[model samples]
Target: MKTFGIMTLNFESEALYIDGIAALSQSCGMECFHFLPSSINPLTQQVQGRRYSAIEQRWFDDEFPIPVLIYDRCFYGDDEHSKQCIPIVSWLKSRNDITFLGFGLPNKLELYGTLTTSRLAPYLPHSQSIKDCSEVVSALTKQKKIIIKPINGSQGYGIYYLKKNDKTIHVKTEKNKKIISRIFPNETKLCQWLQPLINFRPYLLQPYLELSNAASKPFDIRILLQKDEQGVWVERGKGIRIGNTGGILSNLSAGGSVIDFSTWSSSLPPAGKEYICSELNFIITNLPYILEREISPLFEIGIDIGVAKNGALWILDVNSKPGRKVVLQTDPDLKETLFLAPLLYGKYLSQSENKERKSNYEKTLYH
Candidate 1:
């Protein structure tokens, strides 16, 4: 069996998500080891329940052998104390023998730009990160109604939608709303109110798709994609997430309810359904290829798509490490399979090695 090494943050016992992935890896014939940075002592060079020293500031499991594959699952920056093992991760990738999965070494800005320029662009909502408030206001005015999301936000957080009228712009949040009047008929006061929010973080301005239910809650579709052993892209599952009434975002973390895409699609008109399917297909097929060619290395992607009142489909966002909640909810049976594909691929390679060994043994006997 191939050994797989995973470098991740300290996941609490309550974090069933991480546990699920670990279990799946083990089932796929990969001996998985999770290195939690928080539990490590810099002075002792040891983690809880283990005795090991850092060689040139890298932690290695003294009991287990060197890993055949290393999955870089750290979400935070490389410099954070919680991510101090990043240098160790880099060292692993430096070795020619170990295969590194997820985030082939790149800076943050370069990685973002790579994804934004790739096939993933279509799945991502139209966004412009501008420091100039004037340019952002102009873009918002053209759209009439638009949403501003933090470029690095997750789980429907830090999303604001602004609806503009003649002289007033109404800013709606997930919890409340604020109305601001245009101070100067020419200058956009709305931008001034938004400037503070933009801060150091990049903000994305996207046209708000009027996706609403009878109760007026906006909803969106979440599609999970994964690669099988043969490197075929497979749609693991799809779900419709309905946001809280009057909410600007639809995320489970934001109190959204997940529903089957079939149920939601059936509720829509035939034309709307056709439009959505066509747009989704375009996003899934063309977008991945585009991202692979244009962006840095990326093997998997999750797409959030919304259908407007006018029956037009819009790409909401593209997530590199999209949650697997929907996959488990929709098809629990495939959860292990989908999540362990990479590990399973490693296992298959190991099996091939065994076959080669047996063939050599048989040849020796025949001779």
Candidate 2:
């Protein structure tokens, strides 16, 4: 049987999702293994990880040669372990003998730049990298309201909404399901807080869109796109993510609720419904191909789309390594399909003639 490996930074990171994939691996004519990048023995090239035993339906302690195919689910942070494992993963990607289901996307700023030149450019909001707090203050002063987010941020962390008032500035963010707000007496105070933040990491600024609903709860449409057994892009599912009232994010991690897409769209008037459907169809159809052409191949993507009160659509964010919560919550029947996607895609790659061909594109795209 062919070998399929699920690589993650932590063994317990996606325990349930990993378990589902491993449980279905044998039926797909593959053996499953789970491991951390740090577990690889640099000298011998063998990995100390767990192998799934189909007969027993359990994982056992085992060491083996690196798997032929890898499903990377590593989420990096500013930590010592993340810094160490990054280079090791990069080394693995450099090898022609191994196949990864997909090469991840670049950071937010790079992604914005690439998409800005594509046909879908109209859907993207104007974005600029922040060099200092002065840029942010200038934007807020000019735009009146804007969003500042980490260039490498995920899960709605490190995103803030800034609004400029005559003598004061307001900053708001959602953390641990709570709305945290602070009133800066002046731009100098806000700059004091923003200087350390911009120094710590890169950030991007864009004008804030009013993405809230009638009740003042922020919401966005979340869609999951993936490659099938034949390596064709397909929409797995989509749903509505509704955040807390007065919140800036609709990410589940920020105390958001999920609703079926049909339920929400049904309430819209015919004209508005048709317009939204058309715009969404255009974005969904073109985004994947654009990313692959300008960056690298990808197995799956999670997109967050914002809707303004004036009926404008905005591409709020795109994630190469998306979570399954929104889709599963909206449609529980897709559980099996989601679990088998990696196995099937990996199998297709292993059997294809171009299995070992690596993209000559720069490898900096992986985050």
Tens-place lDDT per residue, model 1, 1-367, is 5666655555442245444555666456665655554544546644442212223322334544455665556554324663465555444444556554443323223334556756555444565665767766787568878877765566666677767668766776663332222333434566666677777567677777788877898788899876556555778889888887777767877777788888778987897788788788877877656544544334356778787776667666666566777656766787566557657555544444322111111111000
Best by TM-score: 2
lDDT of 1: 0.60
lDDT of 2 at 187: 89
Which one wins on lDDT? 2
- Candidate 2's residue-wise lDDT over 177-197, tens digit each? 999999999989999999999
Off by over 4 Å in 1: 24-27, 37-66, 77-95, 104-125, 175-193, 346-367
Give the local distance difference test score of model 2: 0.91
Compared with the true structure, model 2 gives a TM-score of 0.98
Task: State every prediction's TM-score relative to the real structure.
Answer: 0.73, 0.98
